[model samples]
Every structure is written in C-alpha cells, then in structure tokens.
Target chain A: MANDPISQFQIKNIVPIEIGGLDLSFTNSSLFMVATAAAAAGFLFLTTANRGLVPSRLQSISEMSYEFVASMLRDGAGSQGMRFFPMVFSLFMFILVANLFGMFPYFFTVTSHIIVTFALAMLVIGTVVVYGFWKHGLHFLNLFVPSGVPGLLMPLVVMIEVISFLSRPISLSVRLFANMLAGHITLKVFAGFVVSLGGMGALGIGGAILPLFMTVALTALEFLVAFLQAYVFAVLTCMYLNDALHPGH
Target chain B: MFVVTPAYAESNPTEGTHSEAGAPGGDAHGGGAFPPFDQSTFASQLLWLAITFGLFYLLMSRVIVPRIGGILEHRRDRIAQDLDEANRLKEEADNAIAAYEQELAEARKKASAIAETAREKAKAAADAERSTSEAELAAKMADAEKSISAIKAKALGDVDAIAEDTASDLVKHLLGGSLTKAEVAAAIRAASGK
Candidate 1:
C-alpha cells in the first residue's frame, strides 16, 4: 500500500495529441467535467420535459431546485434579481451535479482543483463588473467610496473597500475548493484504514467496523457538503450582483 | 495511533531498515509523494474556465432565459384570459339579475293594475244591477196603484145602484100601488137629498 491518498489526484492526459508545439490535450479531469455537465443537462431535460401542473417525483425535484434558487436570488438580491434567475439556477444545478459526480468512486473531483473553482468565481465576479459598468457607467466606481466617511479617512475607507472587492475571487474559490478537498481527503483516509484493518484477524475486523461506519457517515456528510457548497456559491453570487446593482446600500 | 503502528509495521517489511536509515517518518512513500503544482494545470484550468463560462453564458442568454420568459408570459396571458372570462360572466349575471328584478317589478305593477281593473268592472256591474232593481221596483209600485184605483171605482158604482133600487122598493110598499113617475122621481130625489 505505497499509494499515497493524495497521489490519486494526478491530472493524466486522456487524449495525447501534440499539435503545433502547443499540447492541446484533454485530461481525465476534463473528461469528468464534461461528463458532469452532460449529466446535468440530461437530468434536467428528462426531469423537466413533462413539467406537468401536478409534478412527478423528478419534476418536483427539478422545480424545487428552481424555486430554491429563485427564492435565494429574490431574498439575497431583491426583486431586480429575478432577471438573473436562469443564470443563478443553472449555476446551482451545474455545481451541485458536478460535486455529486465527484463523490463517486474513480471520479475526479473537479471542484477540489483550484483552477475550476477560480474560473467559476472569476465568471461571477466578471459578470458583476461588466453588468455594473454597463448599467451605471462611471458611477459604478462609487461602490468603493463610503458616503459618510470623513474627508481624511475617505482614502483609507476606499482602500479597505477595494481590498474587500478584490478578495471576492479568492474567497469564493477557496471556500468551494477547501470544502471539496477536505471532504475527499477525509473519505480517502477512512477507506484506507478499513482496507488495512480488515485484512487482519477477528479483532482487526471488529476494529475495521468503526472505520466502515465512519465512512458511511462521512459519505452522507459529503453529500450535504456538496449541496451546501453549491448553495453558498449561488447565494454569494447573488450578493455580489446585488452589490453591483445597489452599490450605496 | 498505536494500533495504526502495528498495521504499518506488518505492511512494510523494510520498516526496520527505513527506521535505521534515519528517516524520521517511517512511511515508504515520501511525504512529498503528492505531485508539485504544475503551471500547465493552472493554464488548463484557466482555459476550461473560459470555455465553460462562455458556453454557459451563451446557453443562458440564448436558451434558458427565453424559455422562462415564454412560460411566464403564457402564464400571465392565461391568468388574464381567466379574469376576463370571470368578469364577463359576472356582468352577464348582473344583467340577468337586473332584468329579472325589472320584470318582477313590471309583473307586480301589471298584477295590481289587473286587480284594479277587475275591481272597477265589478263596481260598475254592481251599480248597474242595483239601478235596474230599483227601476223594476218603481214600475211594480205604479202598477199596484193603478189596480187599486180601478177596484175602488167598481165598488162605488155598485153602491149607487144599490141605493136607487132600495128607494124605489120602499115607495111602492108604502103606497100599496105603483107611484107616478114625477112622484117617484121626487121621492128618489128627496131620499137622495138632492
């Protein structure tokens, strides 16, 4: 058992092809990411295809997910946030499905990687920036200035505001990546114990039972973490968008 | 931690050799077994992020938003149609109720008029019947008066005849023979108190 638990996190190139000195290669992680997206699409399409007035189980799940995100956007960002419902809802579903896919055996946890989470955070932050400028023009810069600060402390307050604004991407990315990485590492560690301990005699087998129970409990906890991380990401996105829209508040 | 030491000792046969070799951590795989972070991974991550973000944004703006808008618009239209139908029905009900009330009022007035006409006709008939009865009674009283006058005339003529006959008979009995015409006349005249 020389296999390090962290060693399994290698990004192996799936399709090895070199073109024009630039290695444009798809990796195992990329494959899983695509699979996660495809799964999300198929799940939504199948669940929402009928969309009957009286919903079936799957449709109800889809609708509940929809309503959940919609309510979050409404509550977090206010009524104007309704226009962005589609984007936020898609974000939630995609992240949730991707996270769940990662929880499976032999699957890559895309969210555990810094790059994937950073990209998602950047997109959300970029959208806020673009929309804010587009909607309010030069006045969007006023978001960094506090209205009631004294003239001498204005620069200090503005610096603080800018620092907070700049930290959005890091905070968002780290929150998701840390949660995914921690949950996966914990599961892997416990699984290793179960295998090693169960190989021994009856007492070892009895001791291994604790690790098995812990694994089950952790798996359940991971599932909750998956949903919670997705929710946190979506709600934070809404909050950022709200800030962009109503900078004074 | 003690239990894990035994399991580790059993797994690695070179545990003693590694311990003697002055490796602080007895694990065969080095602590840095995890691959160092590659710059290429960061680049790939950035590329994938851009791709996904673009794709998702396109899908949202093109596909999802329109679908949601259509569904909401259709729902709004359906609600409006329902409300219009309800309003139309309410108006029809109000018209019907108003018409019913008007008809009821008209019917009541007509019924009262009919009753009044019937009462007036009955009074006219009763008045005619009474007048006719009075006229008949007056005619009957006149006929009874005429009959009584005729009966009294007849009784007076009979009394005059009886008186003349009585006077003639009395004169004849007193004289024991037939009296002369003049004397008889004179006696009749004197008896009659002429």
Candidate 2:
C-alpha cells in the first residue's frame, strides 16, 4: 500500500457524524472541496483587492480569468448569456482549483469522482432545462426539433436530437472524470515504478530514471489537462446555456 | 460500472467503518469499493460541495463581478478622456500656427506698402526741386540779356560822337574850318549810306 496509486483517492473520515442514521461524515474529500472553493475565491479576492488600473502580475491573472470566462461565455452563448456568468465562473474556478490541488502528493482529486462531476454537469444541464422552459415555455422543446428538418425524416432526427441532448450531462461529467482519473492513475503508476525499480538494485536504479522522467512529463501534461478540462467544462456550460437562451436552432 | 445508485449510499458506510477497523494500508486493495465509486463518501462530498459552491457563486455574483467590471469600465473611460484631451491640444496648436502665419503675411504686406509710399513721396519732392531750379535759371538769363542790349546801344552812341569829332578836326586841318555839326553829320551819313 506504500505505492498504492488508488489509495491516494481514498476518502477518510476527518469527523465522522451519524445524525438520524445519516452518514454525513466530514471526509478528506469534503475538506479539499472546501479548500478548493476557498482557494478559488481567495485568489480572486486577494489579488483584485486593489483594483489597480495598471494591473499587477497576480491582479492581471485575476482579471484575465474574469475576461477569459467572460469572453468564453459571450462567444458560446452571446452577450445575453451573461446572466449565467456567476454559475459558469464558479464551476470553472472550482474545477480548475480542485484539479490543480490534486496534483499534490497525498492530495484528493475532488473532480475525479463521478458523482461530483455528474452533479456539476447536472447543475449546468439543469439550468438549461429550467431556464429554457421558463423563458420559452413549450417552445423550448423546439430545441429537440431543429429547423429545416423534412417532415419525412423529422421523427428520426428528433429522436437523435433528444438522445444527444440527454447524453449531454453524462458526456460532460464523464469527460472530466475520466481524464482526471486516467491521468492521475497513469502518473501514480509511473511514480510507483520509479520507487519500486529503485528499490531493486543499482541497475534498477538506472532503470528507475526512465519512469522518473515519465512522471515529470506526465505531471506537466496533467497540469495542461487540468486547465484544459476546466476550460472545456466552462465552454460546454456556456453552449448548453445557449440552448436555454435561443432554443429554436 | 460508473453508474451511481442510492443503494451504495446505505451499504458503503458500514463497509467504511469496517475498513477503518482494518489496517490503514488495506483501505486501497481491501474488500471495499474503489475510492471514487465508494458511495459511503458521496453524501458528505455532495453536501459539502453544495455548500461551498453555493457560497462561491454568491460571492462571485454579489461582490467580485461588480468590482472587476467597474475597474475595467473606469479604465476604459479614462483612456477615452485622455485621447480627447490630446486631440484638443493638437487642435489648439494648429490654430496658433495658423494665426502666426497670417500675422507674418500681413506684416510683410504693410512694410512693402510703407516703402512704396516713401518712394513716391521722395520722387515728388525731387521733381518739385528740379522745376524751381529751372525757373530761377530762366529769370537770371533774361536779366543778363537785358543788360547786354543796353551796353550795346550806349557803345553805338559813343561811336557816332567820336566819328563826328574826327571829321570836324580833319575839316579844320584841311579846309581851314570845321563845317557845321548838322552838315558834317549829314555828309558822314550820306557817305555811309552810299
């Protein structure tokens, strides 16, 4: 278990609670989730406290994140989609911070959990559905029936559209979860290889360098994946929100 | 295998407690579920995620968005005002240059006009002086001509008196007596006329 890669993801109870037979134990996963939220919010708050006209380095990063998410939302859903800015910004920051936090040794990756990712995905799709219906009423169903579909093939097209639409939450959640799960697992395996091989002999020590280098390279790639997955999550959220805004096409 | 079911929520907490009783290292490969799929932690994680995420969303919407947006907007307005000021300054400088050039041209025209008037005045004075000198020279020439005519008339009278004296003296010497003044004058006049 010293080199157990899967063990890194274990959720140990920090404070076990059983109220009314409910397992609401405060675990390492919960701790990191709170930490992720704090870090995401703290970075933005502390850096931009000055609100400098000429931004400092850290302040530039804060402003850049704001503009980055703003432009992403505007591009995906247009200016009218800005109503969802808070939600989209929170999701992006939370996932980004959580993913980066997992890169540390012995840290839990909150986003790697399927339920967490699914919840987030559902949150986005839920917004789309609720707002779509609220704004357009019955016309929101028109999203399933695209414009210019011939009456003959309309049913088949609509069935495909409905299936695709239903699969949005699944695909969105699984993509982030799978990517983080696979990347972390692969990184842990290679790092474990370095440790195990170095333990064997002098010759094995030399062999361990390859995996050591691989671990380093994979760490870099994981960083990229972390940011990329966050961006992907935000962008997809915007596009889905677009459906709520204009559901016809 | 990735599907989430509510049954695991009830089942895994017992397993979790059982695992906690076992060796810590046995948690990963022990007879428990994978950590991500371990439904024992789902309720806690979901609850915490909801709390923190909700707080985050509220903070973003209520505080951070307005602050950053205001900063950016204020910066944009400042830049626009600075640009407008620069344009105004440029226009003012252009007007100043135009005014200077116009004054310079006007001054040059006035200088030439003054020179032209002076030149015309000098020419008129020279013409007047020349005419006065010519008139004074003509008066002097007329006075000199009148004096010369008087002198010529007086000399002619003297010549007549001398000729009469010489003729009377010659008659007294040759014919023993001078003829009368009238006869002598008449004979001399007859000879000069012949």
Candidate 3:
C-alpha cells in the first residue's frame, strides 16, 4: 500500500494460537496458502459440478486445464506414469493458483518464500526417491551412473551425477522462489514510484506515467512467468518420475 | 455506496500509517525486510502448507479428477458413436440412390418399349390407309378409261358421217351439176379405198 516494497511480503500474525510450546499461529501467508489451495480445488468443483456434452465457458476452461495436465504427464512420463497424476497435477495447480493470486493488489505470494518452495521441491524429490526405491529396488542407484561408460571413468562420472541429482531440489526451489520474489519486488518498487510521483504535482503525475506503463508490462510478464514456472515444475516432476520408473536411463 | 466503500477502504491503506508500521523492524535482508526469511515464521508456514496441500491432494484425487475424466471419456464415446451413425447413414443413402437408379432404368426400358409399339402402330395404320387409297385410285383410273372409250366410240361414228358429207360437198363444188346418188355412192366407196 505504501512505498515500502518489501512490506508486502511481511508475514504478520492474523490469528494467534500457540500449541504446547510450538507457536502454531495462523499468518497472512498461511491464509493465502489455504485460500490458494481452496480456490484451485473449488474452481474445478464448481465448474465441473454439472457435467455437459458441449461445455460452457467455465467448463471448457476446466476441461482444457485437465487435458493440458494429462497430456503433459503422458508426454513426459509414459502411460504408466499416469498413476502419479494427482500428485503432479495438484502440485501444478497449487503453484499456479498461488502465483496468479500474488498478482492481485494486496494478495500474498506464497511461492516467494524459500521455505514454501523448498518444502514443495523436497516433496517432489522425496516422491522420486520413495517411488524409485519401491519400484526398482537397488536399480534406483543406477540413476547416479551413466548408461554407456568405461569402467575406469565410471567412478568420476558417478560422483558428478550424484551431486547433480542431489542439487535438483535446491535449483528447483530457488528457481520458483527467486523468480516470484524478484518479480514481486520489481513490481512493488515501480508501484511505489506511481504513488510517490503522483503525490508531487501535474509534472510528477506525467513522469509517473512511465513507471505506471512499466508496472503494467511487468505484470503481464509476471503472468506469463506464473504459468511457465508452473509448467516447468510439472514437466520436471514428470521427468524425475520417469527416471524413477526407468532407473538406468 | 454503503457496501462498495468498505471494500475499497479495506484494499487501500492510508500511506502514512502503513509505512510507519513497516519501518521499526526492517531486517538484515536488504532495503526492506521480507518476513518469510525469518526463522520464527517457518514452522507455521510449513505446518499450514502440509495441512492444506494434503487436504487439497485428497480433494482433487477423490472427487474432482474423476468427474472431469469421465466427461472426457463420455465425450470421446459420443464422438465415436456419432461417427458410426454417420457411416451408417451414408450407406443407407447410397443404397437409396442405387434403388432409385435401378427403378429409373427399368422405367426407361418400359417407356422405350411402349414408345416403340406406339411407333409401329402408327406406321401400320399409315400403310393400311395408303394401300386403301392406292386401290381406290386404281379403280377410279379403270372407270375413267372405260368412260373415255365410250366417248371415243361416239366420236368415231361422227367421223364417218363427216367424211361422207365432206366427199359430197367436194363433188358438188367441182362440178356444175349434181351427180346421181348411186354415182356419188360409188365415188365415195372409191375414196374410202374400198
């Protein structure tokens, strides 16, 4: 609301309720996270409540998103990978809804926090580990070994693959968190200019037009980034799950 | 105005108070503090994320996804059924066209047979009428010949009389006096090449 660009990310306690010794207070971020999840789920439920042969506008949107996720999973990981559709689709919807909600004036961006993004990233990696081990046994270790390599150089290659495999969550989490955080910060900073400059006079208002235009353009870009990051996350999950499904490759 | 005003006021904060409240604890992050990085808030955010995400996962898997999938499957089945119906209709149309063409061809053959018999009847009637006309003309030609012969006979009888009269007149004209009837008769006989 004010020129403090970072204040938008401030997690103030909305409803203070502490458990035994662990503080379980509901904050603004928590509220938005719950809201995002609800909104994503509610949108589908409402739109698809009454099924149709020829879909309405909202029905078409719901169907299109469903097909889009279905096709993405099918392409990334074959037909067998569809078993994990709920998890991957939920993850995608949650991130997408959270990112899009952040674009609103006062709504909080849940993806901007490293903790939130990291936790989701860990969930993806954990799914890969558990599923891979459960499905393929010791062959899951083959993920850290290259397919076609000489025995002499295999050890060095294995170490590099292990590091890369371990760093997946770090990169995945930071990519989303950083993009959302930076985009929001830049938008807020420009928005701050619109307010401060408009306060001055007619000339200040005229100058404020530049930052205003920039904010508009950046918001459009952020929208693209929102959809793209969600897509990237889902596709990567499918790819990781594929490795779990077929370990050596 | 009553309903709309509060909604607007809730969204837009008066600048002085918002920034003042924001200033006291701008932390070590950078130009302004982002409270998400704070160690204290992590437990709550994580806890809520787990709960809400778990609930969302459950809701989507149990209820929402299946409905959409069923709709898609039903639509696919409908499209396939429609295609099958279209194919059946096309075959029926082709069969109808073939039947119509066969009927048309049979009708054409029957029409041609009727036309041919009609043409033959007209030709036979014309021939019969022509032969009858020709026979009538021949009978009339025979009758005309007979009548002409009768008239010719009458004319020949007059020719003999005329010759006799012409001979008598010639003798009278040549001589000063008239001859006796027997002498005249004898001269006539001689002139007639008796």
Winning model by TM-score = 2
Cα lDDT tens digits, model 2, B31-126, are 558777766566677888898888988998888888888888888999999999999999999999999999999999999999999999999998
Report the C-alpha lDDT of model 2 over A27-111, residue by residue, as the tens digit: 7888898899899889999998998989999988988898999999999999999989989988999999999999998889999
lDDT tens digits, residue span A38-72, model 1: 67666656665664545678866766676688789
Q: What ranges in model 3 sit over 4 Å off? A: A197-207, B1-34, B117-194
Candidate 1 lDDT over residue span B139-183, tens digit each? 888888888788888887666566556656776787667756666
DockQ of each: 0.10, 0.30, 0.26
Clashing pairs in 2: none
- Second chain TM-score per prediction? 0.55, 0.53, 0.58
By DockQ, highest first, what's the ranking? 2, 3, 1
**DockQ, 0 to 1 scale, candidate 3:** 0.26
Of the candidates numbered 1 and 2, which has the greater TM-score value? Answer: 2
Q: Write the per-residue lDDT of candidate 3 for residues B35-110, one digit (tens) a residue.
A: 5575456777889999999999999899888989999999999999999999999999999999999999999999
Per-prediction interface RMSD in Å: 8.0, 7.3, 7.7
Compose the digit string of candidate 3's lDDT tens values, residues A39-89: 999999999988988998999998998889999999988999999999988
TM-scores of chain A across the candidates, in order, are: 0.93, 0.98, 0.96
